[model samples]
Target chain A: MNVIYTDNNATTQVAPEVLEEMLPYFSNQYGNPSSIHSFGGNVGKKIEEARSKIASLLGASSNEIVLTSCGTESDSTAILAALNSNPEKKHIVTTRVEHPAVKNLYEHLSRKGYRATFVPVDKDGNIDMEYLLKNLTGDTAMVSIMWANNETGVIFPIPEIAEEVKERGIVFHTDAVQAVGKIPINLAEVNVDMLSLSGHKLHAPKGVGVLYVRKGTKFSPFMIGGHQENGRRGGTENTASIIALGKAAELAAAHLDEENTRVKTLRDKLETELLKRVPNCIINGDRGNRLPNTTSIAFEYVEGESILMMMDQYGICASSGSACTSGSLEPSHVLRAMGVPFTAAHGSIRFSLSIYNTEEEIDFIIEKLPPIIERLRNMSPFWQEMKKKSA
Target chain B: MWDYTDKVKDHFLNPRNVGEIEDADGVGDVGSLACGDALKLFLKLDEHKRIKDAKFQTFGCASAIASSSALTEMIKGLTLEEAKKISNENIAEYLGGLPKEKMHCSVMGRDALEKAISHIKGEEEKKIEGEIVCECFGVTDREIERAVRENHLTSIKDVTDYVKAGGGCQNCHEKIQAIIDGILGVERPAKKEAPKLTNIQKIRLIEETLEREITPTLKKDGGDIALIDVDGDRVLVKLRGTCASCSKSELTLKHYVESKLRELVAPELEVEEVQ
Candidate 1:
């Protein structure tokens, strides 16, 4: 079975080059960077090299890069740190469509006496800037927004929102986990004070992430263990993973152009073909302004898990509206928030491509998916009854 | 992904007797588009009152499709009476047991079969006649109450799974819960109910508790729970959908809900894990 991975938004495979760069740190350069020996000195230099590479991707100073375990920790750190930094500011400004890494944390914080204003989004999953601006107040301590949504792939106007928040001197942070490699982001050009990225989202290993805390941003550490990460995070460095992340950053920067063109073509082809071949299908997000490689499609009258499982028989790995919240009978909250009816929302499937997905794979999916829908619809009581109702 | 039987996979991949049989002897269709999954089964009965051919079209997920496929396959050559005997459990068993969450897919299949049978009998569709309480799925107050009486539904969430009452918009959960309370006469607040001591009462209580609390939680998981029996406080229960025989069943039962039940009702209710 040829495995075609279309779940890049969930995580990406580690690129060979990134893995090659990390191997030595596990074996030869095994000394702790904090050690005062030649082996340690070599590891220390490599960590700095990695930090500089990561910093370049975000257009932030190298000193601002604080290594963390994963994107969630980075988000938890940034949000909680900002709240802790400003003790008197009780209000938090965020969007309703944020990843649970941000949304759940905000809700948790809200339960703890912190007032949260969850700004709503339009039907396209785009946050209303005017609503966000109207909600901001003197008591607002921070504005936590994401660069790109994981489900719908809708890109927020982060820089503009940041500029608006920055004018008021309110701390601004973005969970840019899905945006870093797929989009061009430079802290120098954008006014965002803090940003989070996950190594696994790119072609790097999991359990490795970076938080770019811009200079002059009031910051406090969420994890208070050691003097590591410049006393910003308190654990021993995940040395090997961090080194791999740096190499991945270099590859991401170099391959950005190819990814945008190549992956985008495959994605567009998949969406266009499925839309054309399958009747009653609709694209879920902002078509033109969203991620180049992400497409969320809702096949009317068919649930997502059935489509995904049938696709899996062909070794096509993708995600679905019903699959993520597998235990929760609810359809995708992201879709629900976008005002997509339950009929369509539960049937939505997300095909998130990376540079590795080929045209042949997309073609195979195009061939396989329609039959799956047809087959599922044939047994659908609702569709049968719907025809009866209509007739 | 759900653990579909090869039979289910085969049916899902190449469903038999697909599409609508136009101008058929009888057509039985149940569910609404808003119900997330629905089935319409068409039957052509022979002179002997046997179903010679059955075709179906469904609007749902994998299990729904497979269930419809399985239903058509199961009913071929069966007498009308024999076909009527086919239960949702029989259809699910034909597919080597469906995921509990996807069990509704099978239920949809059964509803379609019953409706088809009813249609052939010259009865108009048995639409639940009452006030439309659940605006999301158009479930009626009588329908919600009936599910409560038949399925022993204890909560609004259970009512949603059995009949898709409050699955959408969720504006009618309280209304559905009110129906369950009215029908079951469950006066103790779900949080304040005491655990039953006798076997039958314990079983009844377990069903009541599930109808009330566990169904909502399981419905949230794209699944549902049913009370099998009560061996003292050792409640023998069957898990469905993603939860059925799942690896996390213990954690889900022991830690998540059972702990809550212990805190609320009986501290000694032993929820034994069953297939």
Candidate 2:
């Protein structure tokens, strides 16, 4: 069996076209983009082109974007910038579901005498707007919310929240790593002040990301060194990766409509089939509004690792919400926050799709997974004896 | 994943003496749904106080299943004294050696066996003459000391690996350590504390906790819990009758079980849900 890659949310394999576009900067185009020479100036043009391509995707101007090494760096740059820009504002409002990249930073800030209000989410993984609104005060520096959650794929109401922050003259930022290519992002329409995105999430190379700093937002550079990214970000440009990210962004913009329709259908098909075939199975998050390519399922009884290992035996790859896999002694916080049972939490699997996934591949997995679950359940003393006791 | 030997896999895949023994002389059930695993051992004792037949049903992860299966196989045809002599080490050895993390699976098996023998001897509620060291699982100093003597356990964590002592909330961890230090005759070595339970032990603790705390609470609410299995630290269990579709408050079973197990056995045990 060909190994199916379903953990796209973790990090995607670089697209062939993106890699091809990046190959030149490793040798042929090695000049510093800021040098006075034509070779360096030519390198600068390519960077601008990539930046423009990225800008086109997000409905922002090329100059508004500042390239960074990764999503964390982008997030750190935006958040710390907002904090440092307004020393008087001591409070930061955020959601409970933000990735550790933001969560850890907020925690560190809290430790350093800054107050952070963590707004709660409902059982559906939706953040409470009223709670968020009530928490936003005069002392609030910024309202940083993830555009879409990494684990549950719950789409946060970014525009609604951003509009509220904008009215208060407070900064609004969003980590768009999981949302960039999966959803239609229009900064021109949304009231967000800053947005962070990673290249690897969209089949571009890792170690490259972009932070869109709205033209008039006050900012401070996170990486302090020689002037780069127009003095807004520091470090020698990851030229090849940036170009690849641009090409990948171009591809994403080109195929958005088709990929959205096709991938969502396949995701829905896999989810529906698995639910039908496997007993006591359930979908983790809301089905109506979510990423087109992600489907999380909870298999009641079997642990996620056992399911994942069996899936590996048949070359079906997926991610899990189990604590054992997450290096925590507990299951995924997203599932826990949603009041998912401990039994199902460890047994939960996330099947995240990409453009490359096919209906036949989904069918193959659907056809193969149920029996594996049944086999595991049959081996279970609880499952087998319970049936007998009940009968 | 646990580094389960072929023997462990064999026993887990084709577990010997599965199902129940009708009119069993004694049935000792331990572990729990919240603890992520549990075992119900059915025993038939001979006139000479020897185990004529031993069978088990486990609800937990792969290692717990293997441990229960291996344990049942180890006790059959052995005298009650011989079965009591079957330490977790002997069970692990019979399974060709479980991973350090998974050592608790075998330990749970041994605990179940001892409990079965104790029950057969009419000693379920009888307390031994030893100070309580691990309050989470009701493990006494004698139990920890015995585990050390039989298994040559060097550390408090090792004792937990073999007997699930000090595996839970760890309020009694210092007490467990004191017992271990006193038994090892080491002048208290001042060192940073170590987590008591291995990954597998954590799962057994969770099952033990669920059995001890969670299920009884559910039973009080007119519901019941049945453990499924312990795979690593993930426990699998099934809710019966009302618990299956009971009010959302049943979620408390998992938290109560996990916290109680972590409190009593080891902090690492996680309660997992099963169908």
**Leading candidate by lDDT:** 1
Tens digits of lDDT, candidate 1, A257-297: 97789999999999999999998789998997898889999
TM-score of 1: 0.77
Model 2 lDDT tens row, A1-391: 6878888999998999998999999988998898889998888889999999999999999989999999999999999999888978999988887899999899899988899998888877888899999988999998899999888788988888898888998999999999999999999999888999999999998999999999989999999887989899878898899989999999999878866899889998999999998998888877877899998898876667667766777788888887435323347778877888876786789999999888889999999999988876765556766677879
Angstrom error of the Cα, residue B167, model 1: value is 5.5
Candidate 1 stretches greater than 4 Å from native? A27-30, A36-44, A273-279, A322-327, A341-346, A367-391, B23-26, B79-81, B127-275
lDDT of 1 at B225: 74
Task: Score chain B of candidate 2 by TM-score.
Answer: 0.60
TM-score of each: 0.77, 0.75
Model 1 DockQ (Cα-based) = 0.30
Q: What is the lDDT of candidate 2?
A: 0.82
Candidates 1 onward: DockQ, in order: 0.30, 0.11
**Deviation from native of the Cα of residue A94 in model 2, angstroms:** 1.7
Candidate 2 residue-wise lDDT, B50-84, digit = tens: 78998887755567778888888778888888888
Best by TM-score: 1
